[model samples]
Target: MIKLKAQDAGLSIAELTRRSVLLKPLPKRLSKITLATYRELVRIGSNINQLTRATNTAIKMGLRPPADPEQLEQLRNLLQQIGRELSQIETEITDDDDIESDGDSEDWE
Candidate 1:
């Protein structure tokens, strides 16, 4: 008994039901990261935390940079990796949040 404009191209009740059924398991699988990537992410995060703490303590004590230039570069690369992984995590979380919110709103409608 519901009507929609042709331009809207909205789902029919049956189509909606079908789509809802298909989407039922999406939230459960959402925001999943591969185990290897997740492990790397954790390692990078730990490195960032440790480096940040050391940097902060050094700054408080007015310490100088390391004599080894390669170590500094390695730290920079690790931090960059951490940043990239965190960005990926944020995107996945946002996408999953959108999917879950859409499902909830559809329920009300």
Candidate 2:
């Protein structure tokens, strides 16, 4: 199992790929999981780009960018939430072991 320290801070695509390989026991099932997650991430990235474009368009249209301080705070909170989720996912990928071990069995009385 790869020991991914918190300092690693999952961020870039290359880092994410490296982390995926670091996972312990490297199960075949994990390959599919990783691909699926990667696809979803791509979609999320696309959405973020669209959002940025829309925000810029709004600015160009002379619209104020979230005049409410609370709205700005909420946006910040949402971004932080997304960051945490991504980090957790990267950690999970790096730390996961595929092969299931035979856990200790208990004798029923």
Candidate 3:
């Protein structure tokens, strides 16, 4: 029997156990392409965040003008690249979803 402490709240231990038993477990592995894309997304996101913070700090400290042309150009390029990559990823996901839906419909026929 499953046991829950008082802090668990709402569901009883038995109910929780029953619900868990009915749920499917997660897959253990992802395709290498998926993993690589996810990692690239993370890396780009982190770089953008760090660059934004650094730019903000520089502005606040009056260390550099808010509109330093070179810095602004670099920031704009980075942002554009991020936007392009995100759009590509979104297209890929939409294509995959369409494929899955087509397969599902076939199963019913």
Clashing pairs in 1: none
**Model 1: worst 10 consecutive residues (lDDT sum):** 1-10
Superior candidate under lDDT, 2 versus 3: 3
Model 2 over residues 1-109: C-alpha lDDT tens digits? 1233212333354554565577522221232355565677667666655666666677888887534445545655676576567556655652233234233232111
RMSD after Cα superposition, model 3:
10.7
Q: In model 3, where do residues sit more than 4 Å from their true spots? A: 1-29, 65-109
Q: How large is the C-alpha RMSD of every model relative to the true structure?
A: 12.2, 11.8, 10.7
> For model 2, what is the error of residue 34's alpha carbon versus the real structure, in angstroms, after optimal superposition?
0.5
User: What's each prediction's TM-score?
Assistant: 0.35, 0.35, 0.38
Candidate 2 segments exceeding 4 Å error: 1-30, 64-109
Q: Could you give candidate 1's per-residue lDDT for residues 2-107 as a string of tens digits? A: 3331112255656645555676322222233443456776787687667666766776788963334456567768767876776666655633355333332232
Best by TM-score: 3
- Candidate 3 per-residue C-alpha lDDT over 11-105 given as tens digits, one digit per residue, 9 for 90 to 100: 56565555567763322223345456668767776776676677778878878744454675686687568767755665455223443232322
Q: What Cα-based lDDT does every candidate model obtain?
A: 0.52, 0.49, 0.52
